[model samples]
Target: MASPAAAAPSTRSVRLQIPRAHRGLRDGIEAWLEAERDQIVLWAPVAFGGGIAIWFLLPDARGWLSAMLSCVAVGLGGMATGTGGRLARILAIGGLLCAGGIALVWWRADRVAAPVLARPVVVAFTATVERVEPLAARDRVRLTLLPDAGAGLPRRVRVNLATGDAPVGAGEGARIGLRARLMPPPAAAVPGAHDFARVAWFAGIGATGRGFAPVTVIAPGAGQGGLRTRLTAHITSRLDGSRGGIAAALATGDEGAIASVDSEAMRRAGLAHLLSVSGLHITAVVAATMLLVLRLLALSPWLAIRLRLPLVAAAAGALAAIGYTLLTGSQVPTIRSCVASLLVLVALTMGREAMTLRLVAAGAMIVLLAWPEALVGASFQLSFAAIAAIVALHEHPAVQDWFAPREEGWGLRLVRGLGSLLLTGLVVEAALMPIAVYHFHKAGLYGAAANIVAIPLTTFVVMPLDAAALLFDTVGLGAPLWWLTDLALQILLGLAHLVANAPGASVALPSMPVAAFGTMVAGGLWLALWRTRVRWFGWLPLAVGASWAVLTPAPDLLVTGDGRHLAVRVDGGLALLRDRAGDYTRTMLAENGGIDGEPALLADQAAARCTPDACAVDVRAEGRAWRVLATRSGYPVAWRTLVAACRSADIVVSERRLPRGCIPRWLKLDAAMLRTTGGVAVTFAGGRVRTVRTPGDRHPWLVPATVMPFRVARFDGGREVRRRALQRRRD
Candidate 1:
């Protein structure tokens, strides 16, 4: 054996020779450098152009200038790094110039239209209806406020109308003039709720209008035109006499035209997405277009050139998709699909392979920067997740063979199709579970099953029939197609109805806090993006979030019916209303607090025990108690009773004016007390007793009691006093 000193020399010798042994590493580094140089030359212009566009779109001048300066810094840094090529320098300079141009345009636009800085004025304006829908029993109409004569008039205003009339169409631009309140557009609800304000901003709507007036239509303005209008009109005509309008809605994002019953059926089945023009619809359209284009090319040798044909077809399809997107008002899901399609078209135009993952990422980046708030929207998150899953599954090697069928056997095709459907369902469901739980507080357990059946039927039978019917209607041959579309719609509705009524169709989850929702979304996104098995770690946060939501405590002080007894939220504790009526109110309170009690018994006991003049109040638990002074006449006697009660009782309350002799401990029940009719509350150090007048007045949800002052309570010395002069007048 060699001595320790000898072994050290041997180890040193091996270390010294290590670099020589791996001489190929140096060559590999050189090769990598060469490849990077080529890549930089290719991507330099694209990156520079994108940066410039970003800088231009920045909302503030300071940001725009800073971004422009960053371009210069990047160029200098490239030069200092000693790897800057002629292409890199040229790209940098081009980027800076583009940024400057963007800034100039922004400045010019800003100067041309100075910000309106006037107090919100009530103005009488006439608007033309663009879209209308029922929102929570009220009509919310989006309209274009037609200006009398102005170069820069606010383009649109949303009107909330209290009309019992039917919904108006986009083509029927009714002139609605009203003296409406105007305000600056509000930020989107829930951070990512659809930014109608931004959409209106793009359309030139600076102010929103409310209320309605009798209106007339001057003439039919330019209705939706081009293929979009034609397609929508065609579908509408075909589905006119159909029992089920869902098919037409599924084919075109026109749920407004769908019957309420069919719409509810689909919603219950969790197949409402079928009616919306989403990723599934867009993909179907794209696939159909591609197949038709390929077949037409194959049939015609004269136009079957390998070059430009595919690109041209893709471009046409993309344009059609974009038109459809606009026709559907460019909802987030539709916009996402269009963006992905456009990316694919660009790749095809450049003779590059279009990868789904890359397209999804690019679409996401674009949407986030353009509408950062969309990150919180359910549609944005779910749409992208579904598309990403489909793309990934489509690329998997195990399923690659299914794409290329050896023989067109019915069984083989059916199996392959089913397999693909299952794959898609599993992937999308897994990806969206966290989001569904977080935002909706409910998960459709059978969503995958419903989608499996409904998606294929929708793509193959319903949409095609609807589209064909629309096409036939344009050429005066729609009578036969109409019947066919109707049959297809009925079948679709039946499928939805069956699935919705299936056992365990959906499960309600507990509501989650906003922070937990954010965490869940972040974790899920991380798992989706991760390339390793460690992705399973995402489940930890999801489980934690679910647990937190499930364990959240219930709220306190749930009062039901008008001036009824409060049902203490404690288990088995029951308080009955002074009035024996108002079961609806009692039930509402019970539901709100998860209270268990017999309302009838409590109400009977309360009514029997408490009289108009003298009421006996019980205190089962040691706490403050309230006494209401009741009398047939004379404020002096009532005031004396109230004063005596206040000595022993924690609080004294009266529906009538305070007696002339009594003084209040606390004068004037504040705005907070007005919210609850449980009588003016007298709170002790331990507990509170509320005294509410019977037959409380009803107020609208928006109106706050802070604007009103209590007329009954008056301060006299250190006590409350009510004048007998007013009491005798009432008697």
Candidate 2:
């Protein structure tokens, strides 16, 4: 019924609305980018981390050459930037920082790579005990030994001496002589997994092994290591069981003392971080010290007025942080906390408010520059993420309102306090979720709930009582205080157990792709580092990453580095190839494959037909019937079984030498191949086989690949070159 002019106006209105909406969205994005401009400076480190992560992900390509090239590129970029505008200059600066990060990792790796012993050789040597920890479950005492001068050994060596007939005392200054089988630190169990060798390289530990007999005390050296070790030993010796284990772990940095059951419970309940003396413990100690100092100063009017109460409290807090660091062996996390806390104290003395992000960024840079390997460590990632999230949450106006003092009523104050705890716990748990899934392959479903109880208990009751107990112990009056501390810990431990037992306390997740993890990191950083409605755009990448994780495919086969075990995908779970599987194997199976249940019980679940000689299992993939066989070298495996497997099985796992003519058109992982590759993960898709190695030849610790035979492919106007595979060092 409308006229042509009316219809024209309506069409025009729709067209105008489209552009307006688009313009508004564009403006919103730009405004978000412009907001908190200063915080954009923090992206320099993020870019640097990205570069370092890239270096880690890529295979080693002539280490020294790559390092030199990176350095040169950075220098060239810097010089070239002088001729360009602001955008170019910014890009150049980012490049320089990123290149610098890569170079730092290379330099650190080279500096710490001492000559490793080639084989497990029995060596009789006397070394001073720099530090000592006992592993009673394994009937051995691990020692951080400083080899004597001219010992022709690495500066620092960690040796495990068996407590055979006589128990070895971990007394500092004691020079113990023992014959031990020493070998280089073990390699990574799976590719893209934790590299113990790299960790040892950074820690200055060149070798690891266990003694065949008990260690004999030969001489007492000067400056017996740390008083804290003795103190922890005394406390643990008295307490015994899980109580002593948790107590000793809290007091000292020796978490090995904790019982397996208690540790597992804590882990399941997402309370495992409490056992480590990290940022939380350091903050609590410093905070408690500051409060105590402030109260003491307030009690004396003259001192409060004349002494500068805040300065005194800050100084006390700094000293307390330093002492705790020392007591905890000056570990990486403790050192980071100490440095950050010192920064805070310095800010207080200068009368400048230290922004949390600035302090965190500075602290992270310091740790990375000092220990570049920490960038790969889960602890570093989790700790920094939690701190950043807390800072971001605090800056929210709603959070501020919720936390603000309610002068009207005590009930309101109580509600605000409880809300604050809940929010803090939720923030930390949410921030750590991606990291937890990537590293441990599980995100604690009830972690926030667990933390609601654990955080308050840890911050107030346990920490305070433990600190009081420590102070009392130092002066030989700790018994009653220790009892009180024990009671508190018992309650905390019980809570952990109950939470761990709760239904759906934790959810297993497939190993998230590296790309997905990187995306999530970018999203999380964007969200946490800015303050604008547009910052919510970070959720876009986060959601995409989450979707990718949910859809990613898991590996179908896994092999252990030692070639002593194999796990094949079966019936939506992994089936064990061996009669008995180790803890490491089980954990890797569950984490990497997202498989449930126990390893020892998995062999039967596989419905495998076995004899002392060999075992065979049927597999069906993509409408094709397949067979898998497991056999030992010396076993009298029937020829018919091997022949049938070679014909019908898509994959064969065996240590025995196969017949020359009976080779399968499928995949074969023999002992010799496993040795070369260490461990391997395999997947099948689109009727093709894909494999990934555990100790990929590209790692920094692995020997450089030797130039050998190779082939090149040439396409129309391009040429492709094949890089030779790096060989593993055979023991």
lDDT of candidate 1 over 58-102, digit per residue (tens): 545566667767766765664565645454455455555445444
RMSD of every candidate to native, in Å, equals 12.6, 10.2
lDDT of 1 at 621: 33
TM-scores for all candidates: the values are 0.59, 0.85
Model 1, which residues run further than 4 Å from truth?
1-124, 128-156, 160-176, 179-213, 217-220, 223-234, 240-248, 259-261, 305-308, 348-355, 393-413, 553-731
For candidate 2, lDDT tens digit of each residue in 645-679? Answer: 67766676766556654466677767666667766
Candidate 2 matches the true fold with a TM-score of 0.85
Q: lDDT scores for all predictions?
A: 0.53, 0.72
Candidate 2, which segments miss by more than 4 Å at Cα?
1-34, 62-86, 121-126, 136-139, 146-155, 163-170, 221-225, 474-477, 600-606, 636-644, 655-662, 685-696, 704-731
Q: Which ten residues in a row have the lowest lDDT in candidate 1?
A: 700-709
> Once model 2 is optimally superposed onto the true structure by TM-score, how far is the C-alpha of residue 276 displaced, in angstroms?
1.1
